[model samples]
Target: MMLAIDFVVVAVIFVAAVGAMSCKNLVSSVLLGGLASLVASYLFLRMGAPDVAMTEAAIGAALTTVIFLVATRRTQEVEE
Candidate 1:
Protein backbone atom coordinates (compact mmCIF):
# COMPACT_ATOMS: atom_id res chain seq x y z
CA MET A 1 0.00 0.00 0.00
CA MET A 2 2.74 2.43 1.00
CA LEU A 3 4.74 1.59 -2.09
CA ALA A 4 1.77 2.20 -4.30
CA ILE A 5 1.20 5.56 -2.65
CA ASP A 6 4.83 6.45 -3.12
CA PHE A 7 4.63 5.63 -6.83
CA VAL A 8 1.60 7.80 -7.26
CA VAL A 9 3.23 10.70 -5.48
CA VAL A 10 6.39 10.30 -7.54
CA ALA A 11 4.37 10.30 -10.72
CA VAL A 12 2.61 13.49 -9.69
CA ILE A 13 5.90 15.16 -8.86
CA PHE A 14 7.34 14.14 -12.21
CA VAL A 15 4.37 15.51 -14.07
CA ALA A 16 4.52 18.79 -12.17
CA ALA A 17 8.23 19.15 -12.86
CA VAL A 18 7.75 18.53 -16.57
CA GLY A 19 4.85 20.93 -16.65
CA ALA A 20 6.93 23.59 -14.98
CA MET A 21 9.64 23.19 -17.57
CA SER A 22 7.36 23.06 -20.58
CA CYS A 23 4.81 25.69 -19.63
CA LYS A 24 4.88 28.88 -21.66
CA ASN A 25 3.14 30.98 -19.03
CA LEU A 26 5.48 32.20 -16.32
CA VAL A 27 2.96 32.14 -13.47
CA SER A 28 1.75 28.68 -14.33
CA SER A 29 5.30 27.44 -14.53
CA VAL A 30 6.12 28.85 -11.14
CA LEU A 31 3.06 27.25 -9.61
CA LEU A 32 3.96 23.92 -11.13
CA GLY A 33 7.46 24.16 -9.79
CA GLY A 34 6.07 24.83 -6.34
CA LEU A 35 3.75 21.87 -6.66
CA ALA A 36 6.68 19.61 -7.44
CA SER A 37 8.56 20.91 -4.43
CA LEU A 38 5.55 20.39 -2.20
CA VAL A 39 5.20 16.81 -3.38
CA ALA A 40 8.89 16.24 -2.79
CA SER A 41 8.48 17.43 0.79
CA TYR A 42 5.70 14.93 1.29
CA LEU A 43 7.93 12.20 -0.12
CA PHE A 44 10.67 13.18 2.30
CA LEU A 45 8.29 12.99 5.22
CA ARG A 46 7.06 9.59 4.10
CA MET A 47 10.67 8.43 4.01
CA GLY A 48 11.03 9.43 7.70
CA ALA A 49 12.89 12.71 7.27
CA PRO A 50 10.55 15.18 8.88
CA ASP A 51 13.09 17.93 9.36
CA VAL A 52 14.17 17.84 5.74
CA ALA A 53 10.55 17.72 4.71
CA MET A 54 9.70 20.86 6.69
CA THR A 55 12.68 22.70 5.27
CA GLU A 56 11.84 21.65 1.73
CA ALA A 57 8.21 22.69 2.15
CA ALA A 58 9.13 26.06 3.65
CA ILE A 59 12.07 27.02 1.48
CA GLY A 60 11.80 25.07 -1.74
CA ALA A 61 8.01 25.21 -2.08
CA ALA A 62 6.88 28.37 -0.29
CA LEU A 63 9.71 30.85 -0.18
CA THR A 64 11.17 30.05 -3.57
CA THR A 65 7.78 30.06 -5.27
CA VAL A 66 6.87 33.40 -3.71
CA ILE A 67 10.20 34.89 -4.66
CA PHE A 68 9.98 33.67 -8.24
CA LEU A 69 6.40 34.81 -8.62
CA VAL A 70 7.24 38.24 -7.25
CA ALA A 71 10.23 38.55 -9.51
CA THR A 72 8.19 37.53 -12.53
CA ARG A 73 5.48 40.02 -11.60
CA ARG A 74 7.97 42.85 -11.31
CA THR A 75 9.17 42.36 -14.86
CA GLN A 76 7.21 44.15 -17.54
CA GLU A 77 6.12 42.05 -20.49
CA VAL A 78 7.63 42.96 -23.82
CA GLU A 79 5.03 44.40 -26.15
CA GLU A 80 5.42 44.09 -29.88
Candidate 2:
Protein backbone atom coordinates (compact mmCIF):
# COMPACT_ATOMS: atom_id res chain seq x y z
CA MET A 1 0.00 0.00 0.00
CA MET A 2 2.70 2.43 0.99
CA LEU A 3 4.73 1.61 -2.06
CA ALA A 4 1.75 2.18 -4.29
CA ILE A 5 1.10 5.53 -2.68
CA ASP A 6 4.72 6.49 -3.20
CA PHE A 7 4.55 5.51 -6.84
CA VAL A 8 1.42 7.57 -7.38
CA VAL A 9 2.93 10.62 -5.77
CA VAL A 10 6.06 10.28 -7.85
CA ALA A 11 3.98 9.91 -10.99
CA VAL A 12 2.02 13.02 -10.16
CA ILE A 13 5.23 14.94 -9.59
CA PHE A 14 6.59 13.81 -12.93
CA VAL A 15 3.41 14.72 -14.76
CA ALA A 16 3.26 18.12 -13.13
CA ALA A 17 6.86 18.78 -14.10
CA VAL A 18 6.16 17.89 -17.70
CA GLY A 19 3.02 20.01 -17.71
CA ALA A 20 4.94 22.97 -16.38
CA MET A 21 7.61 22.61 -19.01
CA SER A 22 5.20 22.10 -21.87
CA CYS A 23 2.93 25.01 -20.94
CA LYS A 24 3.02 27.83 -23.47
CA ASN A 25 1.62 30.49 -21.19
CA LEU A 26 3.74 31.83 -18.34
CA VAL A 27 0.83 31.81 -15.91
CA SER A 28 0.01 28.19 -16.66
CA SER A 29 3.63 27.22 -16.28
CA VAL A 30 3.87 28.97 -12.94
CA LEU A 31 0.71 27.28 -11.72
CA LEU A 32 1.94 23.86 -12.84
CA GLY A 33 5.30 24.48 -11.20
CA GLY A 34 3.53 25.35 -7.98
CA LEU A 35 1.51 22.16 -8.22
CA ALA A 36 4.67 20.17 -8.71
CA SER A 37 6.21 21.76 -5.64
CA LEU A 38 3.06 21.06 -3.64
CA VAL A 39 3.19 17.39 -4.60
CA ALA A 40 6.87 17.23 -3.75
CA SER A 41 6.09 18.64 -0.33
CA TYR A 42 3.52 15.92 0.20
CA LEU A 43 6.07 13.34 -0.82
CA PHE A 44 8.54 14.77 1.67
CA LEU A 45 5.95 14.57 4.42
CA ARG A 46 5.25 10.97 3.55
CA MET A 47 8.97 10.25 3.71
CA GLY A 48 9.05 11.51 7.33
CA ALA A 49 10.61 14.93 6.67
CA PRO A 50 8.05 17.31 8.07
CA ASP A 51 10.45 20.24 8.23
CA VAL A 52 11.47 19.93 4.60
CA ALA A 53 7.88 19.47 3.56
CA MET A 54 6.79 22.58 5.38
CA THR A 55 9.58 24.59 3.80
CA GLU A 56 8.81 23.27 0.35
CA ALA A 57 5.12 24.11 0.74
CA ALA A 58 5.73 27.56 2.12
CA ILE A 59 8.67 28.63 0.00
CA GLY A 60 8.70 26.38 -3.05
CA ALA A 61 4.96 26.33 -3.75
CA ALA A 62 3.51 29.45 -2.21
CA LEU A 63 6.25 32.03 -2.25
CA THR A 64 7.87 31.06 -5.53
CA THR A 65 4.57 30.80 -7.35
CA VAL A 66 3.46 34.20 -6.15
CA ILE A 67 6.77 35.69 -7.17
CA PHE A 68 6.55 34.20 -10.64
CA LEU A 69 3.00 35.37 -11.12
CA VAL A 70 3.90 38.86 -10.08
CA ALA A 71 6.86 38.90 -12.39
CA THR A 72 4.78 37.56 -15.20
CA ARG A 73 2.19 40.26 -14.72
CA ARG A 74 4.83 42.94 -14.86
CA THR A 75 6.22 41.70 -18.16
CA GLN A 76 4.57 41.97 -21.57
CA GLU A 77 4.16 38.90 -23.74
CA VAL A 78 5.70 38.86 -27.18
CA GLU A 79 3.60 38.16 -30.24
CA GLU A 80 4.87 35.98 -33.05
lDDT of 2 by residue, 1-80 (tens): 98999999999999999999999987899998999999999999999999999999999998999988877776755321
Best by TM-score: 1
For model 1, give the 10-residue run with minimal summed lDDT: 71-80
lDDT of 1 at 22: 96
- Which residue pairs clash within candidate 2? none
| Backbone steric clashes in candidate 2, count | 0
lDDT of each: 0.94, 0.91
What TM-score does prediction 2 earn?
0.92
Model 1, range 1-80, lDDT digits (tens) per residue? 99999999999999999999999998999999999999999999999999999999999998999999878766744331
Residue 68 error, candidate 1, Å: 0.4
- Candidate 1 ranges with C-alpha deviation above 4 Å: 77-80
